[model samples]
Target: MLLALLALAAWRAWVWWEAREPADHAPAADVRIEALNDRISALRGDLRAQAQRIQQADATNRVLRDELLGMGQRAALIEDSIARWSDPDRHGAQALRLDEAELLLAMGQQRLLIAGDLDGARRAYTLAGGVLSGVDDPAFLSLRQVLVQERAALDELGDDPRVRALARLQAFTSELDRPTDAVPVASAPADASWWRRAFSTVFDIQPRHRSLAVRPADRGDAMAGLQLELTLARAAAERRDVEAWRTALTRADAWLQRLWAPSPELQGRRDALAALAALPLSPELATLGSTLEQLRQLRSVRQEP
Candidate 1:
């Protein structure tokens, strides 16, 4: 369109020059035509320069578009790699390390809070310490401290007089299998000849020097009394009644001493009971509940997105 317009303007200039040309001012008309041609040439050059610039700009845009696509592909690859690294099933290095810690924490919580297994809980806490040792993130610092505090609490429980006495007393109950004052009669010796055994049995006779062993008609009453004492001790321990527990232990000890012969194990148990009874019975530890709750809260917050 610009070229067409330039052509039209040139035609009009030529007609005007022809009309004014009366064989005079021929040189001036030629000069005006040359000037117009030069202006048209300059205008054409400017249009070409603009077109080249536009082409260069389009090429640059394509390069930029391709770069963006390559970048998108690279970004997708990176995202996939990250997902694989963090996936729980994959158990990548970091994931496995963290999972061990979490599992230990969960186990500890389950044992201490639900099952009331102090030994199991302590083991879990110890395992957690090993797992968490490698973790340096500030986010887990509180959890680590809580675990330490919990382990310490368990240690304190181990030292608690009431708990110790209860455990020992419970063990002692199983050891009371021997009836203190009771003895079993020996069976008669077998006779070499059937006739001789028959004759001895028929006469209900033995050697004149052989002594008869005495057997109780029934020892149910004695067994019942012992069982009752043991039950009372266990119940007292469960109730955390220090006085009742002591009384029950004392009665049971006296009953055993009266009926049974003293043995090494029995002596050891008595000594342990005496030592435990001497120490002041500690009240239930309230710190564990609050510590566990704090740990649970921390775990939940850390799990949040």
Candidate 2:
């Protein structure tokens, strides 16, 4: 019974000590709780800052990705351009240049041969040469040399014979249209005798073999014939018919002899007509179509399977 009572008293004392220890540590517990709350608040602030940093990094990654996409597109475009320029078939800008050059060459030949336009032909050839010069291919280098030779040949030609002939004909026509001065006939003196004057008026003698003066009515017919012959000559010259041009000019000379009294001016005009008839309508060109033909040949060879 004594031992039981002592054990009870000890248990009571332990319970009381435990209760007093909690009261003594209450202020320290409050301080530790406040410190933990402050730490938690600071941790929350750090988490928010880290989240903002992550968002900023994501935005920067998006911007970098967009820039990379634009760079990739530009790179693709550059590659396509390189592929187009390096094509071997010549179906790109080079082919277009060649086609233009060929067209200009043909135009130049036609201008020279058909139209007798030397200046126009030269201009076309010059433009064609300039176009051909842009070609970087070594195979066409000889063509450019041939073109230069042709241009030099044109330069050597000086002026077109047809143009000179036409100018001479126009001058002849202008002279023909001018009024001829009346030649003063030999007459007796002003104080001559009445009988001499009456005889001179009654019997006027002119040489038969000399050029018979055309009557006013016949003058119109002669003028028309002369004009017709001149027109024929012009047409023949335009047609590049050497034989016909000479024949028409010969007929024109015959009409001129019939229409006009022989004078220095008339003789000079006849000489000009003869000179015009002798001029060549088409000047000989050895290397006329050489460049065009060579270009065509080169193109054909390239196009072959």
List runs of model 1 lying over 4 Å from the truth: 1-95, 113-116, 159-163, 166-223, 229-284, 289-299, 302-305
lDDT of model 2 at residue 26?
A: 99
Error of 1 at 164 (Å): 3.3
| Deviating ranges (above 4 Å) for candidate 2 | 1-87, 180-211, 238-241, 261-266
lDDT (Cα, tens digit) per residue for candidate 1, span 44-110: 9999999999999999999999999999999998987887667654355544666776777677667
Clash pairs for candidate 2: none
The global Cα lDDT (0 to 1) of model 2 is 0.83
TM-score of each: 0.36, 0.56
Q: How far is candidate 1 from the true structure (C-alpha RMSD, Å)?
A: 22.1
Number of the top TM-score candidate:
2
